[model samples]
Target: MPATAGERPLTPAGRRVLEVASALFYERGIGQVGMELIAAEAGVTKKTVYDRFGSKEALVLAYLRARDERWRAFLDERLAAAPSPRERVLATFDALGEWLRAESARGCSMVNAVAEVPAPDHPVHRVAAEQKSWLRGLYADLIVQAGHGDAGGLADRLALLHEGAVVMFSVGAMADAPEIARDTAAALLP
Candidate 1:
């Protein structure tokens, strides 16, 4: 059974488990981490972790969902603060750049999760893909609002740059990938 929305309030112990799992998954890669290690890190029994999350896949879904919520909230807040469509578009780049600069930044967790789980039937992949698609749609909407004639093309170009920069940062190629993307985006904006 899935955890109910109302039951997401974490107890101290449950919070510890989530903290450990998130860190381990981000640092070590999801495929490499085991339930036992997560339990040990959280200082809880394996059963306790199981009780809260049901299974590893479910936990992975929860982790990606949390990340999706955080990024969306940040974007929404920035759009709200900006007075014009162009400012909102630029603010999106600024927010992404800030996110990229944070130490220990593992690029978009949802994208990472999808890469880890390619099986189309996997629940984690499904949730992650849905979140990613939602992000793409939101970007396309913003571009349209900004009066871009070819919003689809603009959104595709931005998505490519954004995702490419993330992969580049993940492999340690460029620390300023986001800035590069921002520059390119600013030049492209109508």
Candidate 2:
């Protein structure tokens, strides 16, 4: 159910279900929320939820994919606005800061999903790992473009800072965690 072949377009009700599920899944842990609550919140029947996503796992996957898409779009926009590679690398942190302040109150959704689904082989857990791995690779690519040595090492460090900031900002109640991470990452650069 994680990867449906030639997935059909979401109907309006399906869209509503996804929207509601995304919120509930992010705010509350995936294990804490159920199909019944998602359906009730979206004003759709449980059958409609099943019809749209096939199963709860699929719905969870859909929610993770949708959020990942949005975050990538946001980061892309910020990266595009930067004129240089170094600035672009920093732009990632800036984007994260803005995204955290504006949209994410509970830290990274992927991180939360991983916490909720501890089984490494689970589809949800795999998706969450993929998201984090992608971010690390992104940093590596950006650092390479910036002419940094040991892009892999520095990228790993920077990615940790970014992720740590998210958790600290949300659960640790450190309001300026992103900014602190950004400064530390900038220092690591040059």
Model 1 scores worst on lDDT over the 10 consecutive residues at 1-10
Task: Give candidate 1's root-mean-square deviation (CA, Å).
Answer: 2.7
lDDT of each: 0.77, 0.90
**TM-score to native of every candidate shown:** 0.86, 0.94
Q: Per-residue lDDT for 33-151 in model 1, tens only? A: 99999999999999989888878876777666766676778778888998888777777777777776763377777777777888878887778768767767777988989888898
lDDT of 2: 0.90
Instruction: Please write out the lDDT profile of model 2 over residues 1-190, one tens digit for every residue.
Output: 1323247788888888988999999988899999999999999899999988999989989999889989999999999999999999999999999999988988889888888888899998888888999999999999999999899999999999999999999886799999999999889996
Candidate 1 backbone collisions, by pair: none
Give residue 8's lDDT in candidate 1 (0 to 100). Answer: 65
Residue pairs of candidate 2 with colliding backbone atoms: none
